[model samples]
Target: MPNIKSAIKRVKVNAKANVANSQAKSAMRTTVKKAENAIAANAENVQELVQSAHKALDKAASKGLIHKNAAARKKSRLAKKA
Candidate 1:
């Protein structure tokens, strides 16, 4: 829909970034959910799950897929649950 060349390029770039960000965010959320579920179930592997979740959150935050403080908050909550 963008007629201008730069505008068209921008649109494409944005679309690509959006897809990548969405995937990263979804993965991060899934990891967090796993950690939470482990906690809820009193699973012995909660620490391992939390660690992986924190790593995923940090990776997402570093890539600008999620806010740094939001990631930190989530990590803190996950840690607290363990």
Candidate 2:
């Protein structure tokens, strides 16, 4: 539906970026969930799970997929739960 050539190119780039962003977000959520579940189940490896979650959050933040404060908050909460 884009009338200009640049607009058409923008649309294509936006679609690709959207998919990449979505995948990163999904992975971040999954890592957080795994950490939470480990805590809830009273797993002995909670520390490892927390570390994994923190790594994922840091990576997401570094990639500009999430705010640094948001990532810090999540890491703090996960650490507290563990």
Candidate 3:
């Protein structure tokens, strides 16, 4: 509902960014959950799951989707579990 041209463009761009960020965050959370489940179940692919989770966390942090410290903390916790 932005009347100004620049404002309308900004709104559109923000909407696109929001969708992309949401997807990235969702994927990251799913990866972390998978790693946690694998660890708890004593699964054979626990290492791979953990590694993917770490990668997802790093990607999210680097993209500003999550705080760097937050990502580090999650990574540490995942490591501990593994």
Candidate 4:
């Protein structure tokens, strides 16, 4: 435990941020997976799913949740897979 008041506050803030970042990352992964599944199943709405996945990846990248290169790489792979 942080004994200093500011340290304690910082710890709390970091904890909250961790939770938020984890949720965002999880949602992004789910979006990407949905796109992949649509590809595998040859779903009619695959385009829409891929678009959604791209949006999610871009959003996460812009938010600094993931590296821009990582996002770009994933988007490229998704496009190739489609």
Worst 10 residues of 2 by lDDT: 44-53
Across 1-82, the per-residue lDDT of candidate 3 in tens digits comes to 9899999999999999999999999999999999999999999999999999999999999999999999999999899989
**TM-score, prediction 3:** 0.98
Per-model CA lDDT versus the true structure: 0.92, 0.94, 0.98, 0.99
Provide the TM-score for each candidate, comma-separated. Answer: 0.94, 0.94, 0.98, 0.98
RMSD of each: 0.8, 0.8, 0.4, 0.5
Number of the predicted model whose lDDT against the real structure is largest: 4
Ranking by lDDT: 4, 3, 2, 1
Please count the clashing residue pairs in each candidate, in the order shown: 0, 0, 0, 0
Best by TM-score: 3
**Clash-forming residue pairs, model 2:** none
Name the lDDT of candidate 1.
0.92
Q: lDDT tens digits, residues 24-43, model 2?
A: 99999998999899999999
* Candidate 3 or 1, higher TM-score: 3
Candidate 3, which segments miss by more than 4 Å at Cα? none
Which residue pairs of candidate 4 clash? none
